[model samples]
Each structure stands twice: as C-alpha cells, then as structure tokens.
Target chain A: MLIRELERLENLLQPWREFEYINREVFRTLSPVQVEFPLVNLWKNEDKVVVTTEMPGVESEGVEINVTGKTITLRFERKPEELKDGEAYTRRERRYGEFKRTIELPFNVQSDKVEAKFSKGILYIELPRAEAEKPRKITVKSE
Target chain B: MAETVKDKNRENRKIYAPAVDIIETTNNILLFADMPGVNEKTVDVTVEKNLLTIHGMIEPTIDDKLTLVFSEYGSGDYQRVFSLTDEIDKNNIKATVRNGVLKLVLPKTEKIKTRKIEVSGEA
Candidate 1:
C-alpha cells in the first residue's frame, strides 16, 4: 500500500519534470535571439478567432493587413530620422526596418467581415467564421 | 569544463555597448540586438572592411496625456560593432527591423563551401 502511494506521487511529479524540461529546451533554443520583443497571442471563441500582436513603437497607419484564403499577413516599416553629424551618441538600442509576419488560420474565416484594430502598440484582428462553418444546434427525436 | 567557465566569464565582460546575440542557421544569420525605444530612421547598419556596425538611437517617450505610474525599462541609444570574419558573405547581408527587433540575414558565400577533390597518381 505504501509503494502504491509513492508511485502515485512519482506520477504526479512526472508531468512537472516534463514541463520543466520542455521549458528549458525552449529557452535554450531561443537564447540566440537576443531581442526580447513583444509576444503574440491567438485564441478561438465560439464564432470568431482572435489574434493579438504586441507591436510597440509602431503607428496604426504604418501597419498593413491582408487576408487571403485562411492566411493573414501583416507588414510594416519604420523609418527614424538622422542625427547631426557632429553630435555624439551615448547609448542607442532600438530596431528599425520593415517587418512582415503571416499566420495561418485554424478554421475558414469570413474574409469580408474581418476587423482589425490597433491601440497602444497592440494589433488585434477578429476573424468571424463563415455561415456554413459555424456550429448549429440540432434536435433529435427518438423513433 | 574549465574552458567553458572561462568562456562564460569572457562573455560576461561588458563593453561600452549592449551585447548582441547572433545566431547562424543554414540560410542566414539572425541578429538579435537589445535596442529599446529606437525607431526606424535613427537606426543605421553598415558593413565596411568586414566590420558590421549597428547604430541605433532611442527617442525619449514623453507624452503629456499619459501619466507615468511606474517605469523599469531604460531609455538610451545603442551602438555595437562586430568584426566579421571570412565566414560571412560580404555581398549578401540583409537586415530588417520590426517591433524593436532587428533581424539580419547574412547569406554564406559560395567560396566558403567545402569541396572534396579526388587524388590520383600522375599519368
């Protein structure tokens, strides 16, 4: 009986160990990408799929959004001004240039009804499901 | 183990600029630089005599409407220079910046590829 409890405890800790191992591996793989940029989160609700991307220092007008089939593309470019030739720089660290990212949608999205909003350096995209793809309630009667 | 420890110590030594992480893959080399609050036009990347230099300037964030409650990230310009060896192809260095992340893709030159030749006795 005591051995059974120990086995149960080991089984509970196994998942935690696996989680730690996976987290460490991900960190090790991403260690070379030194820039700590904002993260993107995607979630699916009943009727719509939402995508939120954190893009600080980017203006709403600068971002270009395109949707084709089940894929969404985002493209933008940043251009900073030049400083005086005689001026000296102390510490400078900020990324500037064109960036493009494309994501595939899990389900078929209604291309015509897609909505995009940008606020506080965050871009939010809402993709509603087509009429045929949406879930419908069905009634069953016993024969 | 001792050599690895020494290498870690060497990497820890701070220079005047921020440390950059450069990752080399099969197709390109991704350059991740920590540059806070730097915009597009202020950033300059140039390669001269096999020396790659990344210069960035961060403008101060001063908004009258927004009230500052707490702040942790610092605001400063970033400058780092890397001496590139013959491993990187000089002609095909491409750079892109997005959301404060600078991605540089350095393509390898054809001359850098290894070639095996057959050895035969002279006829």
Candidate 2:
C-alpha cells in the first residue's frame, strides 16, 4: 500500500515539474527586456583607476582595449559554439555576439601608460592618472 | 573534502545562479555554465543518487586599498542543482572548466530505439 501511494504521488507531481520547466522556458524566450551586457566595476585610490569586467568563454586574444584621455573603450567578440551533426540546444540563456563598452573617468588618465590583462575570462585594466590630475599636497609654511 | 569547508563558510555570502545553456545529442547531454572568476581550484561538481550539483567559489579580485567608485555587477559564488534520470551514466559523467565556463557531458547508458510493428490481415 505504501509503494502504491508513493507511485501515485510521483505520477501527480511529474506534470507539475514539466509545467514549471515549460513556464520558465517561455518566460525567458518571450521577455522583451534585456539587461546591459558586459557589466563592469571601477575602483580608484590615489594613483590609478582600476576596472574589471566579466566575459566568460571569451579568449584573451579577442579582446581590444583603447584609452584616450579619460575615456576607456573595450571591444570583444563572443562566438557561438557550433552544434554537431545531431546536437541541438534545448535551453540557451547565455548571450554571444560582438560587444563594445566605453567608460569615462573623473580625472584624466595617462593613455600610453594604461595596462590591461585578461585571465580566466576576466578583464583587468589599470589607468594611471595623468601627471597634471594628481592631487598635489600643499605645504603650509610656518608664518 | 574542501567542499564541506566552503559550504560552511557560505553563510553570509550571496550566491548567484549562473546562466547556462544545455544541449542534447543522440548519445549525450551537454551543459555549459557561466561562472566568471572561478577557476579549477574553486569549482566542485558532484553527483549522488541522480542529483547533480555545481558549485563555484570566487575570491574577491579587488585589493583592500582600492575603493569602489562605480559598480554594475556583484561578485559572488555560483551554485546550481539538477535532477538526473536513470538513463544517464552517472559514473561516467565528465566535467571541465575553461575560461570561467563549466562544461559537463553526460552520456546516456543506452540508445532510445523506435520500433515499428507490422500488422498482417488474416486470410
């Protein structure tokens, strides 16, 4: 009797699970709103501004970084994986395509001295502050 | 293993559900999960009794001296779980991490065959 009851409960719950999966799939595919791509974070101290962004599945060689004055631009391309002869994607939530992002800093940056590194699909950039933009410590002489 | 230790430390930390893409072939199912900032050392994949779980730990990349000026995305650990059917070969499942993406290949134990039956009319 216990085994029969358990089987009956399983049969009842199976459709609910399938319904939930289908609901999620429809909502994700039909939603028109989209979030901004390649989200970034910026940090600063005294000498330089550090920026980071996550780009999973992207290689280092495909990324391009440009710095002009206080502005930094990042460009990259994420290619979609090709399916084999009999393979088909049942669910696809990851985005893939060409992407470009531009960031402006509050202070001027040394464009030539800017450095960037890519590892494990994360982009790290350091933009040194321009010499003229550095905060100068004013000395108060005893009068 | 180290998995238990990390799970204990996850009390106050936020966990994010990483986006994934799942593909199905004739003999295998493939799953790709995006988990940036997690490398091989911090990722754990396990399967027990038809339950598959994926966990990836992330260490803060920003230095202590640096103050966040602007932000858009939050850094956190990634975790997801899925239920598997008995048709999958659980013992032979393979997982690999590359460029912050985790790929899991689950092979089916047997091919699902379709049989067509022929009907004969009695004379």
Candidate 3:
C-alpha cells in the first residue's frame, strides 16, 4: 500500500518537474518545444510476433527500424503541417515532431527474417521466432 | 481479455474521437485527421444541413487465436462532426485518404468569372 501511494505521488510530481524544465529552457531560448510519440500494440504467438504502431503523417521515408537481439527500436520524423498565409486554425489536437520508441520482445526473435509493412498510417512488423525459442517436445525412454 | 467480455453487444462498438488539425488559408481550409487503421473504402465524409461529419471504421481487436501481449491505443470507429459556414464552398471541396490520414481541402469561395477585355488600339 505504501509503494502504491508513492507511485501516485511520483506521477503527480512529474508534470511539475516538466513545467519547470520547460520554463528554464524557454528562458534560455525564446522558443517553445513539444514532442509526442505514437501508440504501439504487440501480439505474440508460438511462431511469430506482430507489432503494430499508429503513425499518421509519417512518410514512408522517415521511418527507421532496428532490431538487435530481443529488442526493437523505432524512430520517426514527421514533417510539421502548415497552413497558408492569413489562415486561422479553429481546432488543433494532432502533434508533429520526432520521437523514438524501443520495446523488448517477450522472447528472442529471428532478426534476419524480420519483415515490416506500412499501410494506412499503421506500421506492421512481423518477427519470426528464433529456433532456440520455439517450443520443443521431448520423448520418454521405455524401461 | 476482460475488456471484451464486459461488453457483449457487438453492434454497440465504442466511438472514438480522431485526432485532427483544422487550418485555414485565405482561399481555402485544410483539415487533417489521424485515422491510422482506416482506408479510403472504410472512411465516409458527409455534409448535411451545414453539419459535416467524418466517420472511419477500424477492424475489431478481439481475436480468439492471437494473444495480446501489450497494447496502448484503443481500437474502434472514429466519428467527428463540424459545423460548416457560408464562407466555405462545399461543392468544390475535395478529400483524400491515404495511409490512414484523411486530408480535406475546403475551398473558400465559388468559381470566379473570367472576362475577356479587348482594346480598340491593339493590333
């Protein structure tokens, strides 16, 4: 119970720390900066692992994927969308910036045979299971 | 696993509000919506009685065979509405959906007439 309370307090303190950091940076450079990361989903089975991420406004050329051992790293750079001169914006919710996401796999995967596909703003990656990670059945010797 | 069993009504899928950016220019307005799981065939944009609505359907996430390891974003249909004003030329508006992003270009005014001027002193 005490650990949970501490965690709650930490979560509440994070925003204030970020606010202070932003203010300090704003004083140094008369400009503001913001960043956002896309959401990710992972699904795994006996033979393969599938990873999906939502990355709207990211061009196909701006995505980079690297797999080393049981971890995968994704980097994205999306161009900031702009409006013409004299235009007014009514509502703005989507954000544009550069971000990176790295996640460890549940198990070791075959890095050489990994495949990635991008469609409709979603990035789908399929990683085959390593031979050692695949399930094996053992036979018993008869007495 | 618990999220699916709690709601058995398949037709009552949750409606999500898609992230969008609305920008205006002197001659037109541009709307960009993030709908990553939707394709052109699955998206519908309609304007009725000055009410503009955008709808996109995404595949359900509940699967019997595949086991979920980790998830961050919710999966469902996206629906959003905006009121149109007289400044917009609805007839010339065009929209395109690619890679789950929808871009709608709303022109500011109607077509302008071109007048041919001839000078008497011109050869």
Candidate 4:
C-alpha cells in the first residue's frame, strides 16, 4: 500500500522535475515551423469605422466580406497542393482550410456604402457611419 | 531496444520538418507553430519520454473551376517532432489553437533550479 502511494506521488510530481530544459528545446525547434497570419483591427473615426487585417498570400476574390446592420462577417477558403504518387513529403507545415470571423460594431453602419480593398495580404474595410451616428459639435452659450 | 529507439527517432526526424518558434518568458515557454489551416480536430500534439510531436493534415479548399490570382502561403499536411531535455513540467503543458496558430504553454518544473544565491562571509 505504501509503495503504491509513493508511485502515485511520483507520478504527480513528474511534471515539476524538468521544466527549463524542455522549454529551451521547445523554443529551439520552433523557428523553422513558425507560421504568421493576419490579425484584424477595428477602429472608429469621425466619418467611418476602419477594419484592417493582415491576410498575406490570399487572393482578393477568394475572400468574402458581408455586413448586416451592426455586425460584420468574413469568410475564406484555401486549397492544398497536389502530390504525385510515390513522392513523399519531407517537411509540410502550411495550412489550407476555411475560416470565418464576425465582429459587432458599436453603432449601426450603412452596409450598402461599405468599401473593401485587399492589397499585399492586407484587407481594409471602411464602413461609413449613419448620418445620425456621426458626432456633432454644439456651441455652448453662457447664461 | 536502444538501437530501435534511435532508429525510430531518426525516422521521425526525417519524415517532416516543421518550422517552429519558441518564446520563453519568466513563467513559461510558449511554442508557436505556423500550421496555417490545420483544424483542431485533425491536429495532434503528444509528449512522451521527453519527445513532443505535432502532426496534422491540411486539405485543399479550392475547386477546379476557380483560378488563383496570387498565393504566398502553400497548403499541405503539418508535422513537427521535437526531443526535449530536462526543464519541462510535462504534465502541466497546455495547448490551444486560434486563427491557425498553435500556442503551447510549457511551465517550468518545480524541481529544476530557478534561482542562485550569493553567500557572503566576514573577512
């Protein structure tokens, strides 16, 4: 009974025995396999809300952008390569799949007048604010 | 048994080479793998006997009728093998995938030396 308890204790304590070296090895082996993708950023301006995302290596037509009222959605698909028979891959790390991301805006936006542009793997979305939503300046009179 | 282990290790090492980035901080080590389109269902990450392996399959999404205008990222299967030494708390390793980025947090082992002390004596 005591031996079994000791074994269980050892098992529980195993992960804490060697963390530094494992971390170093994990970092050392990561450089060649690292993949970087685009991140989406949304900000509001005086007249519009700008959405920018890094999407390097994707075609403009392959991406679909849609907006409904206060919500915006994006969807895209990527294809994999064709391999010949009897040919084995040495190193394969790129990803090819479909993805979708949707974000909600603080205020209602005009979907019909929205503008989108893709250049150098970056997608820029400009959403014009409704006439009522734009900030208005009012003069204050001293009483 | 040792020879077989070595042979298997060599075979695994030769099969797929994945580029990896290991970011180390005070609390843990973050492993970021550029596995572009690998879904969570198909991806596998395992650690055994100090050896960590990440393997997954990436399928193409294009059709025959479509023509590609530009492509900077290639799509294919993903595989990476790593041999770890001491310094990892294997049991506490955590992994999460978001937006095609595989993030792994490897915490430092409690038994490993983490600090040094300086002793002073009166002359």
What lDDT score goes with residue A84 in model 2?
A: 87
Residue-by-residue lDDT tens digits, candidate 3, A31-103: 4544326788899989988888999878878899999889999998887676555666776778777789999
Q: Model 4 misses residue B91 by how many Å?
A: 1.8
Clashes of each: 13, 0, 4, 23
Model 3 CA lDDT for position B72:
79
lDDT of 4: 0.61
Q: How far is B66's C-alpha from truth in model 2 (Å)?
A: 0.7
Instruction: Rank candidates by TM-score, best first.
Output: 2, 3, 1, 4
What TM-score goes with each of the models? 0.41, 0.82, 0.75, 0.40
Order of models, best DockQ first: 2, 3, 1, 4
Which residue ranges in model 1 land beyond 4 Å of their true spot? A1-38, B1-123
Candidate that scores best on DockQ: 2
* Candidate 3 to native Cα RMSD, angstroms: 10.6
Predicted complexes: DockQ each: 0.03, 0.46, 0.30, 0.03
Predict model 2's lDDT versus the native.
0.82
Instruction: List, in the given order, the native-contact fraction of each candidate.
Output: 0.05, 0.76, 0.73, 0.02
lDDT of each: 0.60, 0.82, 0.76, 0.61
Write out the backbone clash pairs for model 2: none
Instruction: Count clashing residue pairs in model 2.
Output: 0
lDDT tens digits, residue span A3-98, model 4? 001222332444532353365358658868443334466667567777766553467899999999889898887554444443233334445678
Worst 10 residues of 2 chain A by lDDT: A1-10
Highest TM-score scorer: 2
